[model samples]
Target: MKSVTRSLRILEAVAQHQPVTVGELTKMFGLPKSTVQRTLVTLNEAGWLRANRKDTTRWEIGARVLAVRPAALQGSSLFAAAREPMIRLRDTLNETIHLSVPDALQSMVVVDRVDCTHAVRTFHAIGDTSPLHATATGRAILAHLPKADIDELVEHGLERFGDSTPTDDGQLRADLARVRADGYSVNRKQYRPDVCAVAAPILDEDGTPLATVAASMPESRYDEQRVPELGRLIADAAKEIAARRNGA
Candidate 1:
């Protein structure tokens, strides 16, 4: 019972100050480093807290926590919560807008979308699955996933979908790190030869990603100079969906 209580306390601390280091957690709990490390290892294995991919020294709440909690926007209501924002974004950018959630299989699945009317545009069905390391929408959610989950994907190896896909483990890791820092991800004809995209995570109150929002366009219409702007717009739209969920 004492061990269980200590584990909960450590989890609480991680939830309060996520991406925290062992030294910080030890200091916060006034416990020995060994004790904290042992508890952290247990929690991490159980999917309670995950190490940060960028800096393994730090830890954050894991994907398991998100799995136990219902998605911020889920079921039929998810479309209701996301439709307006998706349409608004598509209108603003004239690009295909996507709303997707990471599924039990650790793959991202599109739930809703607003298609661009352009002669040359990207499109996907409502239930299409995307590769975690190849698609912007997938990476956006993956960037916020627990390190243990990320490691599982890495161990499985990133498969190549197109010429631009990052097949190298180190390269993909670096890309995920960049996504974490930028709060978004971009794909340059990675998932499909003609498609370019930018995506952002929709996070819950605990900072766990519940889903992702993405804007995809034809390579001919995508401009490298506009990536940052496009990414920001997508991120803002995703946040609107998350805010609606939180308010409800």
Candidate 2:
């Protein structure tokens, strides 16, 4: 009984502070290092947790956890609110549309998606995760985060995923500033070499980001001249989703 309770508690903690290290979990629970490690290993084996892809020493939520949950949005209001707008955006642009929410400040997890009919469209599994510094979906949310939170994420180090990924703190901050000013973000093969995306955030009543909606496609299909139009469309969709979610 005690073991089960501890395991559940540890799982909740991991969900709250994902990409967390075992040493950090140990400190959080005030448990022995060995005990925390054993629990983490057990959870990993059970498919409730997995090591972070960028840093294997840290743990994050796994696909099975999302798979077993009802509708996989963790009961988020954003999912229901964004569904229609996401579909409309996909139909309008003929590109894949994704809805992602922050996993703490570590990464953005795809909670929902509307797929386009194009054979070469970009795709992300519903539970897939992407770095907050390197993807348009992530940058949209990151741009709205509190400065202290952004500072903490930057201090943790941004791992470069591709040539276009912003690794330097100054560059990343500049990119985020552009996102704030433009009301959207653009990713040009930043996270995935073949993909390009434009995204905007769904903000809560307090103007904090609740989720992001992105229109993604293969780099070969991206049109630089259409970026402003695409950005405006995505931003409008995001605003509509936010309004619906907030019952406004």
Candidate 3:
């Protein structure tokens, strides 16, 4: 109860002060800096708050927090619908499966996931964010969004995470073009050297992507020869999910 109370207070503080800093929170609450820091981290991880990219020390309400209204709940509802399918995919492939939605133009946040039981696997927590230009899951959705939106995201700058990550706008645009043509995106150690992933977008009735489903594994476990086949499996799964969702 005390922990919950403390977290609530932090949320209240953040709501009252937009783009506030840790020092400001600590001072205002008269709490230990470490306690405030931990609370802030927890809130940020839960998608209630986001630290500024330009100034990591400052924090503000996250997109998820800001999107608590009815319309945004569509994604939350999508998470519920995707649960069984994600689990089935994990069971079938014996690999970590992630369901993510666009959190911002430049990132996708994991809403749910099924972790692989393998001794070596790519691990990510729910609510974790991945860069659009460097992740299969992010690109899967990005490829389906408006070109103007994609251009704006690129204009913001692509932060490279790995040697294979695309940093140039032209190169990233070309990559997105391929994703659209192929109906799936593949990340070859672009986000993490040890992890590779394949992903497909779950489209709405209007053909706009609402979310993505991804399968990730250690590079060692990834069979290069099976990449196309695996991509096809995920793409088919995504389409089936979209069909079911539309029917519902």
Top candidate, metric TM-score: 2
Best by lDDT: 2
Instruction: Estimate, for each residue in 58-130, the C-alpha lDDT of model 3 and write its tens digit.
Output: 9988877644532354466576677788788888899999888887674787767789899878888666777
CA deviation > 4 Å runs, candidate 3: 1-76
Q: What digit string (tens of lDDT, one per residue) describes model 1 on residues 124-238? A: 8666777878999888887887888888888888898887798887888889999999889999989888888899998998999878889988889999999889888888998
* lDDT, candidates in the order shown: 0.85, 0.90, 0.84
As for lDDT, the candidate ahead, 2 or 3, is 2
**lDDT of candidate 2 over 1-248, digit per residue (tens):** 38899999999899888889999998898999999999999989999999999999999988788665326565667778888988999889999998888888877888788899988778788778789999998889889888999899999999999988999899999999999999999999999988999999999999989889899999899999999999999999999999999898
Stretches off by above 4 angstroms in model 1 are: 1-75
The worst-scoring run of ten residues by lDDT in candidate 3 lies at 65-74
Point out the higher-scoring one by lDDT: 1 or 2: 2
- Model 2 reaches what TM-score against the true structure? 0.82
Question: Distance (Å) between predicted and true CA of 221, model 1?
Answer: 0.3
194 in model 2: Cα distance from truth in Å?
1.1
Runs off by more than 4 Å, candidate 2: 9-46, 49-62, 66-75
Shift in Å, residue 69, candidate 3: 11
